[model samples]
Target: MTISPLETLQRVFGYESFRGDQQAIIEHVVQGGDALVLMPTGGGKSLCYQIPALVRPGTGIVISPLIALMQDQVDALLELGVRAAYLNSSQDWRTSRDVEQAFLAGELDLLYVAPERLLTDRCLDLLSQGRVSLFAIDEAHCVSQWGHDFRPEYLGLSLLHERWPHVPRLALTATATSATRREIADRLELNGAPHFVASFDRPNIRYRIIEKNEVRRQLLSFIKAEHEGDCGIVYCLSRARVEETAEFLCENGIPALPYHAGLGAAVRSANQARFLREEGVVMVATIAFGMGVNKPDVRFVAHIDLPKSVEGYYQETGRAGRDGQPATAWLAYGLQDVVQQRRMINESPGDDAFRRRLGAQLDAMLGLCETVNCRRQRLLAYFDQEIAPCGNCDTCLEPPQAWDGTVAAQKILSAVYRLWRERGQRFGAGHLIDILRGKPTDRVKQYEHENLTVYGIGADLSEQAWRGVLRQLLAQSLLAVDHEGYGTLALTDSSRDVLKGERTLMFRREPEKKARSTRSASARGKDAGIVLPPDAQQRFENLRVWRSEVARGHGVPAYVIFHDATLREIAMNPPASMDDLGGISGVGVRKLEAYGEEILRCVRE
Candidate 1:
């Protein structure tokens, strides 16, 4: 009965080996040590604590945030023949009482409960009666008030260490910057725990940032050309925008469902169920979604608006390519977005110091957007990670050309000054760019900007080129947005340098207006390409269909039946018997006994 972590991994969960630092973390925890694990979304963070919980003496207590997450994880553990259960509001009192009894009777190996529930006196008393194995805090990022997914209930989780001093604790998060990481440790009283920080590189996901032209059109073109029949998540900044974007995608032949807090609870649950059970169903959502989603085949994560910070962006995009397949993290931003974000930061209810911190976070994100270096390199640099050129992002694939934009920037800034300070009028980037590029538009004529001294003085650059210059100016702090004037451009102190010819400006050339038929991001990865020949690919698809049907019957996600990677291996090798199927990576003794014969039958067919 004395089983090692490696033995349990192969015999129970069906993995041949540990990934990255899982082995080390698991071994440390099994020996009564504490840890703070920072791993990427798909980096096997679960196994680190899961194995230790199984090998340790008593039931593992997991403090989770969401009911769906707790259910999905317990379902997966049950499929592996582990004694797992979850207690949350989703279950009635009878079911909750039964789970509690099972735990007290030593019938459960792992038990998950929400932080709010775990903080209750009754729940705390129940834990004191049992021989607890360890405490695993999932989504530890929520502990930080400055983080994107802050939950007030998580602040009380520090009691786990205080109440159960003898029990070792592990806190895990998919995304956390240095500041958030430090805050999690300080708040959770895990400052002295072993910190395991994995490389933040998601090599399978391609990063692309495009200047916003038209949001819907660009999103449609990208999806139609690159991910026609793929499952993905499209994130918007507002709930209203989420509904509109979901409807738009549905009207254009893409199956999309809207998910936001505005929707009824029943409707939101139904929509999420469809997204998980079906394939290629796009979920258009705001930041309210995608915390505990376990879908492994999300081919893309598109953002129609800028996120609050680089950590939020990284976490949102990290949802893609969870299965290590080729995926894309695409974003579309423009000048108006810059103004809107600044306004939000200024208008936040936080104090002056908090607002300053939020502003710094935005500045970091804007820096990533405007950097001339590799997108991945600049993004990782925000987390204090230095990396070489990724050669996969849009910047690395075709580096943007830079030019001496001093004269152009001055022309644009002078136009703003004349329109606001001299003429007693304010205009947005469109009108300012029009004046700079000498466009004969009705707005220009109606405002009589055509007769301004700065009008038509510099028409060397195209409209997009002018916009690019202005965007860079905003990013570089040479210009500010006058939100009271309906997002009119304003001159900053640094603008004086360029206006007085004291500074020379350099800006990256904008991308072409026409959409190019670029290769899919997955094409750059080894497994994203065709790993099997035509015949084997056919077999893999057939196995997938079979798995889907079985999962539906069992009311679980398809991956819980068998991951796509495991199915592909089975299809390629064509197991001749149950014995051969058991030899596969993900096929353990219990699963082989449950569905091995059926899988072999499908392979034969």
Candidate 2:
């Protein structure tokens, strides 16, 4: 008996359709072909593996990196009434023993184990005992040296295939460059695997790279103006920053929470649960959160500092607007951010080659920050995916008008130089913004009537726009900020060429956007229409449990077993099984022999 991929999709997963070539990819994997999948978060990458696991004859072994991710996958499977289990540090001795027993007994359809755990002698012995159908490497890019979050343990996972040659394998990640993709293939011994590269263009995400000025003001402004009452994630570079940002947001009437490695287990879990279950809670976290979170309605992701690399930025920002609704990817960068990030890279004790690679990665991230092109197109093109203009980002939806920034750039640079010479020090952005506004208070008066030509030249432009220009200039190394003397400003090496008119500065004016709407992203056709309304979904899930039990008795994957959509259709149609099952999309020729009796038992029961 044979079944089409579409049947599995509708029946087991409960979806009536496949998302962008997912059916084709699943068919390939179901046919026991190798695959390398590159899909963004909320893009249904998991379905590619979960659907295949149901079709194959034996348990699917998923090699994942983070324990949090393992738990999330298992939890999601459990919710769908699939027989899934995970092994990680969080498990106790008896629980671990039970999982091993389940594996040997062929009672589990999907087993997720950490990469390092899979390398152990006892675990390897058990894996050797199982009738393994497929070995999936989630976060596959981590095996590549060029990847931002490389894990040496993941590189060791290639030994699985050397030991189990016939089992098909699939590798998956959210972000990968050309170099990282090749490294992943070579390291994973997937040189011959058929790779499926999905479009990396996140059209629903609005990319806004702003300069860090008054953080609290800017954040509040952006949030109030663009993302009112929407679920959001704010990333800070450190735990302290996370707490501070969260507190500030909370004080300003936004329901926000702080998450970091330093938090106790219970508190962390509670906060995470709240963010996942509760809407409009802006989670201010370090990169510690969101390993494999399935939350699909995150509306915005803001960075208080520049991410270490483009991969990190891409993955972090990808969290937003997962429901395919319009979301914002906002990053506030300044010269200090670049300096701090560079110092972090320089401080690492990696090999010279690794350091060089890290440096290049940082440059790529900076390129994204500095780019004047359509952010979506540039990001997609980086990952070898072709896409046109997004028509939804801040720039695309409301294009920023430009003016001759040459004189403005020169005046800003000149102010920095004159301030450095007179004050013999640096000051914060506030002090500088004040200086540009020709404020002759004690600070300016003490600096001697701001005795400089460019002092009052910037008065024509608003304070907000000037800060943006200066921040960007400093990040690009054209201007320097002196942190020693309270962060006074200074001109970098590039300032000379700008003043000589040998260089011209081109920049966009502020982007204009309409008000946020109440409509969902699916309504706009950006997201897959896979949502289940409140009450109908509850009844649909009850029907799924009955089908899952029947599949377990028949010793087939619940989906080979039954699809969620099939059960939904069944619940809505109340099919009486057997001949009635034939009318369902998922019950095909092969399933008739394998699961016909089970479906009869399910619907009749």
Candidate 3:
């Protein structure tokens, strides 16, 4: 008795219908056709291959870059009553042997292996011995040589097609530009495969970029005011910053754990487990922490430092609001961030072409931060997707005023030029800001900078405003940070236009600061997008408590047992029997048989 794809979707994964191009992609793969799919996070990319694996005659082999997340992925599948297993280095000899035996005996439906392990001859031999329904290469962007998360192991994945010409192959990723997409197709030998590119927009996420002013205090205020008692991720550029931010948050009464490659494996694993298993645990980490995180309820993703490119920024921020709830993507950016990124690029070991590529990526990121237009519009355009201005971003919520800053640009460029031409010396932004505002400090007097004609010509603006002008000039390529690691400012070739009044400059006006609100914490749930009637809210909370207990007993994340969305639906409807519980969107036959009565009893109580 063969099952149809729609029947497999409803009976196995418990979804009523397919989204966007999911059904097409699945049908193509089920019929032994290759595909390259580009979808956003939480867009059900997994089901595209998983459903075909079930309906086909053999186990699906998923080549993932996320070795750390394989257990959780298999656990989630097991909960849905799917026969899933994984082969990775984390398992002991006996466990690996058992999984291998299961695969050879035709006992598993889907199997996940890291790209590194999958490339091994032994693993290939094992796979050849079993029937393979399809090959899914997750995170296909890693095949690009210039990507931030490049994995050299992925370059060998092209052999899968050669080795098994009959088995269909599917390549999937949540982030990739057109060039990267082409690179993946070329490298993986999928040139003739059909391409499916979904919309990259995540509308549930509200994007906000604030000036870095007492950033720690600002982050504290953001969490306290909007996302208290919520699971979130804070990204820093360096390990030292990760540790410091984690400690600061803890001292400020936020339960945070630091995660970086510097930590021991056990500590990293433990912190990651706590973050996934425990409720409201904030993981303060570097970029090392979030590649394959499956947690669905993270309410926010804040970055204290700027990301290297728009793709990386979009990927990190997309981790938020995965469950289709209101979430925040906040960034604290400032002049130092620009200086630091420039310094890193200048000092990188890459050659001229590589460095220029890095510089271009950084420039695009800076444009996003400085743009007065819709953030979402600019972000999606980078991926070659077009859309109107999203009303959810900070720019659309309160349109930033653009002021003609030609005079200010001239003042800053003139300062940099005089310091270089007249004094045969250079200065950083701090001294330059002081010189502009007519602050005759000891450093300014020592350098005789006060005697310069440009020193007191800009006393009309405040220090913050002057810094903003300098930052914008740097962003626009009118100014450059020196490579001497002293953070000194220098003029670029383009500065001549601004100095000669040939170029007009418009800068984003900094919004006026309002006093921080001291509102009570009664609105925390509402802030997390959990809105229900009083009785229903109570029931939802009760079900959550029960789910937590069940998850602990099973040694899996709470979301693996049941997502908040599913539980919320159950609470609102209050299922009367096993049949009613089985009718819910996320309940499959195996889950119904295993826990349907338990869910009904939990709801009634």
Candidate 4:
């Protein structure tokens, strides 16, 4: 007996209906049609292919870049009573053989393989021997060389269509610009496939970018005051920073583990496991972590360093609030970050065009950080999606003050121009700031820079304010960082217009930091956005305790057993019988048969 997609969705995954374009995409694929789907992180992209794989005749082959996450993916499916397996290098010879035999015998509903392994001739031969329902290429943006998460192995995925012309192929990603979308289609030979682009907005995430002032202390305050005892991720630009931040957090009473490529595989795997299974385990990591993490209760994603591109920032921040709960995306940015990124780009090994691409990406990221307008609006605009100002972002919450900085810009530009023209020498930001502010520092006296025409012109602004001006100037391309690795400032062609008073400049004035009120801090930490009655809250906590125990027994993440959303619903309704529990949205037939009675017992107790 064949099952309909809606029936499979309710019976197998316990969902009542499809979201956004899931129904259309699934129906297209089930009918042996190809598709390219662009959806956000928490937008149920998995179900688009998963449901079709179950409704269709043969097993589905999922080509994923996340080899580390295949086990957890299969575990989640197994909990739902779906016949799922994976082929990857992590398995032993016997395990691989068993999975292969299962595939050949049509005992599996879905199979996941890394593109690297899938491209192998042996794997191709194995797949050819089995009946394939459809091919789902996840993280399809990896096919674009310009994408943040480029995987060269994905370039060969076009052969999936050629080898199995009859099998429908569906490519999916959570992040991609229009250009990247086109690139994915071209590289994967999905041009003929229909493209479905969902809204890139994750409204549950509250975006906030703070000035880098004692960043470690700020991060500590953020976690302590807002997200204490909540799972989160802290991203750093370098491995050293990752280690230092993790140690700092641990010393200050926050449990954190460092994760980077520098760590041994076993340590990385263990830390990742703990983060997924344990509650409130903060993973301090470089970009090496978090590509395919399925943990749904992550309350925040904090970045102490600026990311390279808007796409990367959106992708990382989207990892938060995946369960539709309130989450924070906080970043600490400063002038040093700009300088460091500029230096990296200048010193990169890539050719001129490649360097320009990197520079362009960085410029867009800086614009987001510096924009006085809505952060969410500007962020979505980069992906060619437009919307009104979202009140959830920091800018909309507290609109920043924009001040006319035309004179400030001309002064800085004149400082750079005069320093180069008179002494034929360039100076870094500190020396130049000193010259502009008429500070008779040793460096200024040594260089006799106090005689410059722009000397003492910037004295009205504080040192921090002067730095902001310079940073804005750099961001606007009125100034450029020297490629000589000395971090010296130089004037750009556009600087002439600002110096000539032809272009007006407006800069966002950094707001003074106010001390967080004790009452407000306590209030934020009290519920942390999980609002329920006293009894329901107690029941929710009780269920969490039980879920933790069960997850440990099964050697899987707690969310794989049941998400917090599902458990919360059960708590709110307090199902009295097995049938009542089975009626819940996330309670599938297999799960009902496996743990329905236990859930009823927990609810009653």
Model 1 pairs in collision: none
In candidate 2, what are the lDDT values of residues 5-120, reduced to their tens digit? 66766555545578786887788888888888889887888888888887887899998877766766676576456789999888899999999999999999899999989999
Cα-based lDDT at residue 172, candidate 1 = 98
lDDT of 1: 0.88
State TM-scores per candidate: 0.96, 0.77, 0.98, 0.98
Cα lDDT for residue 108, candidate 1: 91
The C-alpha stretches of model 1 lying farther than 4 A from their native spots are: 423-425, 438-448, 483-485, 513-528
Give me the runs in candidate 4 sitting further than 4 Å from their true place: 518-527
lDDT of 1 by residue, 336-445 (tens): 78888877866778789998898888888888888778999998887778888999898988787778899988888888887878778877888887787778899888
Kindly give the stretch of ten consecutive residues in candidate 2 with the minimal lDDT sum: 520-529
Provide C-alpha RMSD values for all models, in order.
2.0, 6.4, 1.6, 1.5
- Model 1 compared with the native: what TM-score? 0.96
Residues 495-589, candidate 3, lDDT per residue (tens digit)?
99888999999999967766647532222453365678888888888889989999999999999998999988998899998888888988888
| lDDT over C-alpha atoms for residue 427 of model 4 | 85
lDDT against the true structure, per candidate, is 0.88, 0.74, 0.90, 0.90
Q: Candidate 2: misplaced stretches above 4 Å? A: 1-6, 30-32, 208-214, 217-230, 251-253, 325-373, 412-463, 480-496, 511-605
Candidate 4: Cα lDDT at 326 = 81
